[model samples]
Target: MNFFHGQETLSVIEWILRSVVTFFFLLFAVKVMGSRAISQLRLLDFVMALMLGNIIAHPLSDHRIGLKGSVISTIVIIILYLFGIFLNLKWTWLRNTIETMPIPLIKEGDIIYKGLKKARISIDLLLAELRKEKIADVKKVALAMWESDGKISIFLDPQYEAITPSTYQLETELFDLPRTIIKEGKIDFQALKQINKEEGWLVNELKNHHQTELNRVLLATVDYKHNLNVFLY
Candidate 1:
């Protein structure tokens, strides 16, 4: 427990214990912050992440620095972060201020130079982002926005958009996600039960259709239509 607080010296085991505790504490903190903090790093999220990392990192490197202070500071920061998120939800102005409004970088096939300056992104960076989105020509973009999360959202002109089944009024089958019945040479009995299948039936199917033994299968999936797909080891 002394290792958790400021100590003159620490054993190898104490150091290991301290690291394990810090790792789990950080995991718990991140869990409390929610998926938004991990996925979309807005202004508030960015600040929280930066502060938490700095606070936790110091104690791990120096034995004199205590884990207790870092943990307490992290908890306080998380609470403030949650409160800030709540305020953002309750007030539109605060949300707009903290998150900021999306700046239009391109509109109607024309680049807005003012938006480029406001977003503080160069034309080369914008072109690089466009390339990542598979838009080779600027003229093909109907709208391009610089999001508050530091990501650029690009919408291609309808004429240049990829043709889909709806474009031709074509009929399509209902969506059905295949359930994994077997993985890594092991049968998922729960998945089998979900599809109203038996172990014996699956083994027999593998023998008859796939012409391979059950253990030889690396992965197997069954669709809504009971179409068994198998990949061998």
Candidate 2:
């Protein structure tokens, strides 16, 4: 009985050790891989990570390289990922620290070469990219940002700031949002409530516009100018 109990305790201890080591190793590997490993990751990066995980998981899980050990390691990795996601949602600072922040690559129309270099972006390539967008002059750019997700966002200098207002034509109307009255062949009752409108209002408007049936209408929306635009067929 004594020998049996000792064996049981040792088994439990071994499992605990395996779990702890596997968790830490996976965590470190993911972090060291950098934000780009997951964000804007290429096909090769994803494949390599998957292959490495499969190979490394075995020894970490059961102290042996086998299918069962690989399964255990995969489970550990999933748990770690879930835990990290939870913490990221709960802690803003942690999320910010782990994730990349948008860096200002251009400030006051001046390119910050150091920032671009740190991001592994070439100044000549960036300038060429801007030119493709019809932005020929860097002096006309108010701000340029290298987003965390590996996308660049360019903010052009305001019309009046970059060029005189008189040089451009003025538009009389403000940009407006389109309203949806129906979706997926079903009436969106919640949308009607939010818009402070009823089903009767939609029916009457459609009828007034000579639209016979709701099913016949593929899409009906109120444009920014408060004009109803309908599409069918």
Give the Å error, residue 100, model 1: 1.5
Poorly placed runs, candidate 1 (over 4 Å): none
Candidate 2 lDDT over residue span 124-213, tens digit each? 878976887789889888898887656788888886255544567764466567877665455778766767778887788778885567
Where in model 2 is the C-alpha error above 4 Å?
A: 1-72, 82-104, 128-134, 158-178, 193-201, 222-227
* Candidate 1 TM-score, C-alpha based: 0.97
| Strongest candidate by lDDT | 1
**Candidate closest to the true structure, highest TM-score:** 1
lDDT of 1: 0.95
**lDDT, each prediction:** 0.95, 0.67
What TM-score fits each model? 0.97, 0.49
> Per-residue lDDT for 37-118 in model 1, tens only?
9998899999998998899999999999999999999999999999999999999999988887999999989999999999
